[model samples]
Target chain A: MNHRVLLLALLLLALPSWAVIETYQFDTDLQRQRYNAFIEELRCPKCQNQNLSGSDSAISQDLRRQLHAMIMAGKSDIEITQYMVDRYGDFILYRPRFNAATAVLWLLPVGLLLGGLAIWALMASRRTRRVPIQPLDDHDRAALDSLLSDEEKPSERSGGNS
Target chain B: MSRIKLFLPLIIFLVLVAIFFGVQRRVQTGDYSPTALPSALLNKPFPEFSLPTLQGESLSRAELPKQWLLVNVWATWCPTCHYEHPFLVELAERGVPILGVDYKDRREPALKWLAEKGDPYFATVFDEQGTLGLDLGVTGAPETYLVDAEGIVRFRYQGALDQKVWDEQFAPMLSSLEEASP
Candidate 1:
């Protein structure tokens, strides 16, 4: 029984060393998810087809890590994305920022909407004020009616002519 | 009538001109920027994943040495993956160690593809669950990663590899990494 106690004490002495705590900079789940969202929204400029967060490309991974670090360093999502934009171009954004370089991108749908409205207005106005075609006079109408009757009288006249 | 009708074509021409300018402006905005993105995970440590080979043996991250190694995450289902296969095969022949992670693929199809086409990897990791892919930030297949031997990612290339990219970007980076390593 004494020998068993000594063995148990030795085991207990070793147990404390086995338990280790690892601390990550992104301690909160919210911060980590935010970082993920930010990366997901950004485009991988190198691979134009992929978003930076979704791409496992080394560059993307690096960018994610960089963003994570930046978050830990207390940088906001806008700041991080802008930093990438400044280094790369507007291509880094899956949804690009509105500036001189990308103003048209942002305003295109609005422009299309306004242009459509203008066209609709123009068409409505044009239709409302259309130049009406005048009806034929009595003499012309009588001639047209007679021509129509003459054309339909072909079978009736065949027997008479014979 | 002659004076008024003379300006009809001019009015039409101005309208056409306005439409043309609007379209041009739209085009400029819709066009995505042609600039390449730098690797986002630069200087960040890689995620942990243990992938088994087709031969059924698992490989760990520790197996890869401390140098610039390209990790190709792909699957047979990915059409773009096939497009980049030949480029990878050629790179493999040139002594580039391609670490392939077969993402969410069946063992048989992957084996068949590797058998029909020439194998291009020094070592392959089978990620059937795609958990590793998520950890690596992969959205789809046919993505490539450039990781230093320390397992820190250096660069990333998305989509398929073309000759021009192989020549311009990867070749130079490969040479430099080789020179920098022991």
Candidate 2:
């Protein structure tokens, strides 16, 4: 394929979504930022892994329009999320809410990290805390004496020579 | 306590394996759908829509046939709908009241497809712009919903429908829905 042809195709592809979104007139910079955050956060129901901003799928187009309408109507972030969730369930969210169904997903890794640190602290504290040594019993002392006999003989011979 | 700690990694591994096998079993038995989403409107009333039917006649929520029925969503663009057409015709012949939604499809092609394939629905709602589908949380075509007599959405099945799916997944629920009705 020619470079010119490839570039033309890409240009044409970018036209659709750009046309719709540019037509939207946001009142404030904060509202514009919210729109950007929203399209990124909301997952396209029809497409896998493509958020609303990335995909030009039919569902995404309709949802983008609805989201714009909601934001323009002064609906809060929570209300917008609730509206999407009510229709599409938690599947539409890139970041699912912390709830009974998703509690494990949200909490498990953090819980593991904390639990591991706690165990490490416990083990480390235990290791550094030295216990007092008991005096050697008579049997142990005799065993130690028998083990040192070879070196003791040299000392004995040296003392005799002295 | 420390003795059990030694087997903690082993326990975690075994638990993970068990969960994997459990999910695998569910997948095989069709209890879990890894791709198709469970409908958000489960046990809720069907979304309100006043749309023209396939024949261009007006219809509305209050005018819905007050009984246990299947609301089948399909489109000419979806190849799976073509595959499931015969099964739908068969079910309709067996006295199943099926309402169709022509999802995001041109009326001419949809009508042509139905005429050629043999129409299976009692009333086919024409949703050309897919507004009704958007309200219903449709991801794509060839989805089905079971609405009880009270207009509550009892079940939703994504993808094509067939006898095996009907017998295993839908039949028991349909029976229960009927039993519960006065």
Candidate 3:
């Protein structure tokens, strides 16, 4: 009778605390793929250096599922990204969107490239002017011929001896 | 005219050098974006491995109840591990149980580091051979995995953590989970 009471207590203790896992399934292939891409491109803010897709950080996972649900509910890519940006700021996007605040982020590279080309053209032209010269004058040609003939001198002596 | 002809190649060489340096400078000044892998592994199950703790006690994914967990793979040899240690401790105090895998470290030193630094994990697993680390796609020390309650591998971080990241990326997502589970 005591053993039966102990067994009943153990079963009651185990019953209420069981975790309820919520599983969400995607209905369409296109929505799933888009959700996958969006999460992969967005950086995981907590881990900071990894994207939501690549990171196994808990936050990244939650964000991925959230993005997945949003996509399934028919949110556009722009809307999804904007919603994240509105909440988290523009730093979430791996390729940060263009705006007045991020114009530098977008345009700085192009400006630098153009500036580099300009500097290159200037330096290239300057170098074209400063390079030292070497001339193939008549004297140099004569010297070269004498040097070549000088090598034959030893052979000529050997030929004479033969 | 012949002198000019001789200098043409020399001029071309200098021009090439200038172009190279110019390109390098441009590269240095631009934004450094994070290059991350695709989402093929999202909601996938965590890799399986059971190993002894630094204390010689056994530890594995099965030991913990199903919840969101941060599995940090680190070693004493890793310099970046030190950089992220404090953040891990804070995460632990906040009720996020961290499972520390002391990869490639001697038992004595691993225990000492934890003792001095304040133990951040509910348990610490030893992966001295790095076999378990490789199975989870750990490229180096200081990698983290976020596993969901169902034991699904939810996310992965390849490097150190910081405040800006914790605030912008990690905190907001966690809010939703707290709402969902509570």
Candidate maximizing DockQ: 2
Docking class of 2: medium
Residues B42-89, candidate 2, lDDT per residue (tens digit)?
Answer: 999999999999999988889998898999999999999989999999
lDDT by residue for model 3 over A1-81, one digit each (tens)? 999999999989888555322345788888768876886789776565788766775445556666776888898988888
Question: Candidate 3 chain A, which ten residues in sequence have the lowest lDDT sum?
Answer: A16-25
Candidate 3 lDDT over B14-129, as tens digits, reads 99999988877755643222433322235677767889988899877677777888889989888999999998998888898888889867889888999999898988889887
Give me the displacement of residue A13 in model 1, in angstroms: 70
lDDT of model 2, residue A117? 100
Model 1 per-residue lDDT tens digits across residues A23-128 = 2368788887887688678877447588865566655665676677788888887787767765455677778877897899999999999999999999898987
What local distance difference test score does each model get? 0.76, 0.90, 0.74
List RMSD in Å for every model shown.
19.6, 6.1, 21.0
List ranges where model 3 is wrong by over 4 Å: A1-162, B1-40
TM-score per model over all chains = 0.46, 0.78, 0.44
The parts of candidate 1 lying over 4 Å away from their true place are: A1-162, B1-38
Return the candidate ranking by TM-score, descending: 2, 1, 3
Cα error, candidate 3, residue A8 (Å): 82
TM-score of chain A of each: 0.60, 0.59, 0.63
The lDDT of model 1 is 0.76
